[model samples]
Target: MYVRHVAAAAAAFLGWALVLSGGPATTATAAASGESTTAAAATGRDPVRLVGAPVLYAHRGASAYAPENTLAAVDLAEDLGIDWVENDVQRTKDGELVVIHDDTLARTTDVETRYPDRKPWRVADFTAAEIAGLDAGSWFTPQFAGARVPTLRQYLDRVRFNQQKLLLEIKKPELYPGIEQDTLRVLEEAGWLGEQQVENRLVVQSFSVDCVRTVHSLRPDLITAFLGTPAAEDLALYAEFTDRINPWHTTITAEWVAAVHALRGVHGEPLEVDTWIVDDPAVARKVQAMGVDGIITNAPDVVREAVGGF
Candidate 1:
């Protein structure tokens, strides 16, 4: 079933490429032009590998510089000239998709103080309006005091408005049952499910194998990534559905990367490897040297500077 979906994805990707005749704006150029950040897909290749250096996705939108998953974080990432931003998605009680990392609100927002009896403060326990009322950024710093937790709709528009690409992770899908469908609906509503966006500007991912598979089965056109490294023996199986295999930096090596790249993704192109959460310059250089395709970092400026040969 996964292999069969590739034919459909290929046709869609090729049609869009022929219509456009070239790739969308490059990340750096897109940053300046407010254009989509997806590169065009040629006949049999995947739309990836922008300009040689590993593409840098500001983890949770430059979390080191601003409150994570907040609009301010994405804005800070764009201000730093990083064109790719990664974010986490969860559902509120009202079924509205929202961008926030923790399942609960205490760590990132002042939910505990606002609703003192709401002990756990799980995001799903609150309505969209209630979640929006909490201050999501003040915990990081007072200057970001009023940054409300953005609904996924708001987050998508902000990224689109900024002309940046997204690596959107469907966080803890099991807890939200049917969230994969909800997410696709929201992405479609935001125009993110369009072929061009799927081919170039968007990638939906999850640490959950079932969630990742569900996304692919539902809409293979969207590029998808699995958040952790699967067993070497399982790489082929994962490639059938996921375009990228992203793992923590410490768990990979040149050989491992080669093994993954040796296989083809659902789009009939080699699977890519992008490692995560690497905040230190030295560690960023380490992963770059290991031949990983991209680095997810809190400081895109620091990592971009650390890894030479742009």
Candidate 2:
């Protein structure tokens, strides 16, 4: 969670910036008018209307309250009343896809203790069965000691059972060759490729431009997002294949959100911006006021309350 802590620190700094500029609520509310006026000229289309508070996505399933990418995390997010959950998917040596964040297993699981000899326990180095035998949740708390890493199939079944929406990230696709095709195969077999699921319940996202394009080409029906910001001039090309632009929260501003919203996606709907990894309420409200369409966070419950109060 070092990176999460760093993001939170950055959020605090941004919150401070909001205070110096004037309160986030008042300043952004006042800026909206000017932003709207220039929005069309900024991107060659009328501004996409800003919705209410941004939608909250449980980053790796309310990870602040549960072990990330575990079934427990998903269940906890559901318990928190968050319908949208974001998770990372990687492939094991046996070609089975699993829900985990890092290329290595040392941080989120008891891998080092389980296999002390396996120096750098990369996720792709172990077979799925080997990974399944390791405890994934004990690092978070003893209460979750036995929580095992979930296979993508198991993860999908659980999410479907809960009737939750998923922002499924294709984490580091380069490490796992042909993972895009492999992932589509899984989503198809699991019924996620169906019309309703594609339209409503799923979004496949990746930081890799090639991977995003590949997913778009393979399943044009499925909504897809690019995880990092492209150049302003590049947004049009991305909009041809991607539906949303999801950037690290620190990089977002009202102007950037407006720029993204001015373009139409492959589906003919205005492109959206969903900023990532913000866990602070002040920062949450700041981004909400910036007109972001979504906030992906480790503390979904807190953000829900924060944005609601704002």
Candidate 3:
């Protein structure tokens, strides 16, 4: 029954794309005016019209087509018309931010086989160079042989050069002592932190309120998203720290969406709600029908088609 629902949703999204062609003309005009103006205008109930084209966020840089969290994956997402490239950030032994989804490096890389004696905590003991030496891509596919782990700087540089927006997830802040500082420093060094204009393009997200709060305090203009599956009572605490809430799709009810929109940020504006890892078209449509601001997924092309027709 579940599989059948997923297929029907996927099919519906595919069929919907055939009906819609491009983004709303109003949104294009708004994007041209600048991020602040556009974001401000979008705050209204109508905001920037989704016009059925859901915001396409490339989950782990389009993991479906390329090695997750790699520069190659981000590039492929850009090529495929993805609006935002999402990636995870973790600190290396030397206090540098690197992009990788897992802390152990077991599932995505050959680290486990190469260093069986070295436990998962061993990652924190190794320098970035040593960590980078592990083949991160081969495990994903034989075709992507020799793909190495990329530093956050390399990842950000590539994305900036490509003019792509980024959704950066700070992973396990407590485990990495100075990960937040290092991450902030890297973005600053890359000239991604200083100015107001650049800040709008970045969305920093984390499950930890402290992590997101730290970033918000340092770079107040930088958009911060609280990533969690919390009860209604817990949401008020989250709202105090972040501009947006990125809840697990399953946890998001229609009432939750309505409630989230009712709560105002520090600026006295409605909070933006984004749900993650939604790949099925019917669920996507249901979420859209519920009026979610964004949906993150591995199959961005599928979501794009679903939202376009919606």
Q: What is the clash count of model 1?
A: 2
> For candidate 2, lDDT tens digit of each residue in 192-296?
888889888899999998999999998888889999978787889999899999999888777777778888888888888888989887788788767677889
Show the colliding residue pairs in model 2.
none
TM-scores for all candidates: the values are 0.83, 0.83, 0.81
Task: Write the residue-wise lDDT of candidate 1 on 172-283 in tens digits.
Answer: 9989999999999999999887777877788888999999999999997778999998888889999888888999998887678778878999888888888898877678
After superposition, the stretches of candidate 1 with alpha carbons farther than 4 Å from their true spots are 1-51, 308-310
Q: CA lDDT, every prediction?
A: 0.78, 0.79, 0.71
- The list of candidate 3 runs beyond 4 A from truth reads 1-52
What's the best-to-worst order under lDDT? 2, 1, 3
